[model samples]
Target: MTSQPSLAKADSNPSSPGEPQSGGTGDTGDGLKAGLKNRHLSMIAIGGVIGAGLFVGSSSGIAAAGPAILISYALVGTMVVLVMRMLGEMAAARPTSGSFSTYADQALGRWAGFSIGWLYWFFWVVVLAVEATAGAVILNGWIPAVPQWGWALIVMVVLTATNLVSVGSYGEFEFWFAGIKVVAIGGFVVIGLLAVFGLLPGSDNPGAGFAHLTDAGGFMPKGAGAILTGVLMVVFSFMGSEIVTLAAGESEDPQRAVTKATNSVIWRIGVFYLGSILVVITLLPWNDKSITEHGSYVAALNSIGIPHAGQVMNVIVLTAVLSCLNSGLYTASRMAFSLGQRGDAPKAFARTNERGVPRAAILGSVVFGFVAVWFNYQWKDTVFDFLLNSSGAVALFVWLMICFTQLRMRGIILREEPEKLVVKMWLFPYLTWVTIAMISFVLVYMLTDETGRKQVLLSLLAAAFVVVFSVVREKVRPRVDA
Candidate 1:
């Protein structure tokens, strides 16, 4: 990490008519130039969308909604596509290292900037903690000698060092990490579809038809209620998808990179998420008790008599966990750096080291990862559950902020430089509002589900915390003299 922490500026005083304007441009480090290539960004878009959660957590969602759970993936994927389009429009214009948070500040207000920036920073820091635990669990399950905590410690320290080197290195690292996941999941989908058609090595079990959808209990075995429930269940798996936009800020051609990634992200998401889920459902009965009993993809692979299926899945899940942790640390550090630059966080966070890494932000995020490990180790069931529930519903908050920023930013683009609108969000405000309404409905439905209710409640508290901070800071800042 850079010794000079790159944080948002501490004083968010807007440039007055007579005052000289400065600061708020992002990533001041020197070791790395903006050199993230298009290929690197493309793989990130493809691989980042398919998180390990799809393989593991999607099982519970499938169990809840039966075969129709494919609808849940389709629904959430569409929402994200619209959201990303909105984000793409703004990013194509500004292309700052600070990403959405800085855009929120410039478009919405200083308060919106600070709140979203810090909240996003907080989100990723917590994710670092959570992902470390996940990676540790997989490693421990595989080796059974080194404790999970030790493995987590190793993962954190190594990734921290990696981020501290340079942004280019981090991009390169994520490129490969994401590439492995892409190949694995993509291959799984192909193999799964083949097995579904009864073309695989063993065809004892009838899998080559849509009969799996209705074989056990028809499409909505648990009723339509569970499909709404499945919406909440599968949404968070898409969390890492937004990181591509953040990294694009540091790319050599931010506008071009963001535009290309944004344009293709929807189809990529549809293929990876909807396509993969479709294969899973067609290959196995959603109502099969084993679907709910074991990890989703792992269980299905076992059904197909794949050799070393569990171990293979354990490796894949472990890779996804590590990739997420690496990205989480990077995201948190960059946000804090942006916050410092914007005058919302301590100024030290804005400084970057010789290698152009945000040293303080990286270490600070890693410290949180360690703390989360302690909580996971000590409380195991309850505290872990609480942590998961609290952050679960904030996916909407993050996405909504991106959408709103884009709405305001679009006008700014026309007034300033219309040339940058090379990549645009289709059906601007219309799709924007539709997306928001869809998110709101999901929130309302979540409030009604007993399981998702906990997540909704915890998320409300988190948003309240953000709102209170924004209000207090707005009140405390000195008024500008005319």
Candidate 2:
């Protein structure tokens, strides 16, 4: 491993000794303003994990694992909670827009930082196209006059402009976008719970009770093997949960925000993911045709006699797609800004305008986003499929890196600065090792599954390319010591 870089010392007394100085290499001074408020940060943290995946992807998990899909969610949710705890530990010590990328640099090396940072940025930029197309499909269905591609273009442009305006604009837009999702999911859970207890006024589905969990093949309908398969299906839904730590870098109090979001992961996962899935299976049998014919959420809503259930879900799902696109652009650009500040990317990407927005970084990501959309329209079956497959396992790769990075970072903090250890990972080395083992197990499991094998192989190919580029760049440029 490369020797860890020395942290830049603050001229003013730091709240904690581990806190980085404002002029450090990690500090861009690109003029990113702390405009995100506590409310915005709180909602972003709450709604970040509630993606379109939960609404749409849960059906497959339910089908694959039967009622035991709840177990899959709980397992993945535990992994995420552990991963985020480690991240929170580092982020609270020295918050930066670079996030885990910066932490990787301090704990591992430039190679780790550059490779992981660019890979993550690439992941989100591709997500922009995926999400915009998703939202556009729904809009085009509503107003048939607009072409699907045209709607995609419109959605991208609007969100791009919102991000370019300022960090606060992105925060405000996400605040309301996520608000709608929170309300929809919360309402669904409440109604479903009521129906489960026979409290709904006109509900008539006799299967809407706790007994449905066992009535449909007795919990492990497909056997214990299917639970692992369900993990692959639902694990990616948790990708955006780390975005709150990233956004916290731009908030009024970075430490407090990171700690709050980190500490709250348990309840968020319990209530939002596990709670919703339990309610879903309770409302309808796992094998019911409607669960797949209409999405799990829609079927659950329909079970309780909600009018226009499909249409209502379409609106919420569309909102989720837009929210993902908005957050994706923000995340990718901020990462680009961090790379530039750290000398891994072109300096132009680090430049911000009067609004403290990285216009070049945002535009750069949007350019690739547009290109990906074009590929989707032209060569979706081949080129687009490759792109999609290659990035599929990036979330796992990132989580693995976080675990390794935290292992080293924890030691460094203890030796050099302990006071900054405000948000600690549970059980230190033991739980950290357990998280690593679980992640490795998932990767090995993916190798056994055909589709998953293809994705992991292709994603490794992409990661290898970035690693080579980072090594060559470091050799040629050789970072000057701070």
Candidate 3:
């Protein structure tokens, strides 16, 4: 059997200033170029967590938990912050496009690395199809001339071309894409807060106040059990927050960029997820039919007498769908490239074009993404359902792995490279264990619900397939001398 790589020494040294960090494993210069600028990194970090889910999915949580839904957001947000903190600690020490997967290989084993890496790549690729389909639906609504499938193809082709052109092109597109989302959400928060405090003109909803939080159903109207259930509803929205850490490896100063992103997690969650939801519930009663009927954000805007609020939000949702598509394509490809570099995938995937983009890797991910889209249309009931359910719980699994990886990675850094510990996990070993237990509880809790049980079981089956493939590949492949 092939031996596991050592976490302590896996690209532990930082690259010299002003040079592109090697993208391949073990200091090899055969990888992506560091063409992304600081502004691009900053915006991607800010916008990475703001997905279409937040805009569209919050209504369900509000309907389920009432004003107490804030507790669910805070609980899940705290878990995300802790997870990102652990990731930031290792990423700052040894920045890599592989992100946590590389750390897993070093700390756990080749089996762990191969399985989690492929699982993550699969997750993003499926997300590509989901986001592409969503964007196509919105575009088709605007322009009836093109069919939904045609629009999906067009969106995929355009983003795939952007990724192929160069890493900078991807960064430039994401910066603006994320910029619009940040502005829209920020504006929503400001306007919603005004409406809540009676500061906005022509805005006087009698129910729009903090009193709505306690008066309506008296907080935890459905009982405290629903708060834990609410976690199942909102936790998936936090999946994309780790993209910044992955993008950091290709930046001019990976450590600095990662440190900045890690430090900002508190406010990002505070203002964006928790803060925005707080305004929404405050502006409209938790039980307001419009909150679920017209959607939470649109309902809040409508309550303030904003003209064309639905149309405005539709445009923003389309932007979010496209942004997710763009980022998903980039993420899946880079992960494929990382897998190749680590010898867990075909070596050709490690090759870069003149523009320093992993052409093969990008195309490879898109190919599967296109396939998934086709399945959505051709076999929506059978094949697509399985694909969707199989990947449903991967985010939770990835978080679980991150928690485990951080526990071992922290000790390795302390013993071998203390100076590189620029970003540390909070209350190491203690909070780390707490995070692990929390994740475990969520997984167990999922088994009780019918839908959640199907998702978790199917995801486990997919993970098992990858683990078996990894083990078999290790056994049959030719051995290399240490």
Best by TM-score: 2
Error of 1 at 434 (Å): 0.5
lDDT of 2 by residue, 227-314 (tens): 9999999999999999998898888888999999999989988989998999889988899999999989999888888999999999
Residue pairs in candidate 3 whose N, alpha carbon or C atoms collide under 3 angstroms: none
**Least accurate stretch of 10 residues (summed lDDT) in model 2?**
9-18
TM-score of candidate 2 versus the correct structure, residues matched by position: 0.95
lDDT of model 3 at position 419: 94
- Give lDDT tens digits, candidate 3, residues 5-96: 55544543222222354554322344578888899999989998899999999999999998889999999999999999999999998788
Which whole-number lDDT from 0 to 100 does residue 295 have in model 3? 97
What TM-score does each of the candidates earn? 0.90, 0.95, 0.95
The regions of model 2 sitting more than 4 angstroms off are: 9-30, 480-482
- Please, what is the whole-model Cα lDDT of each candidate in the order they appear? 0.76, 0.88, 0.86
Candidate numbers, best TM-score first, in rank order: 2, 3, 1
**Candidate 3 Cα misplacement greater than 4 A, ranges:** 1-4, 7-28, 479-482
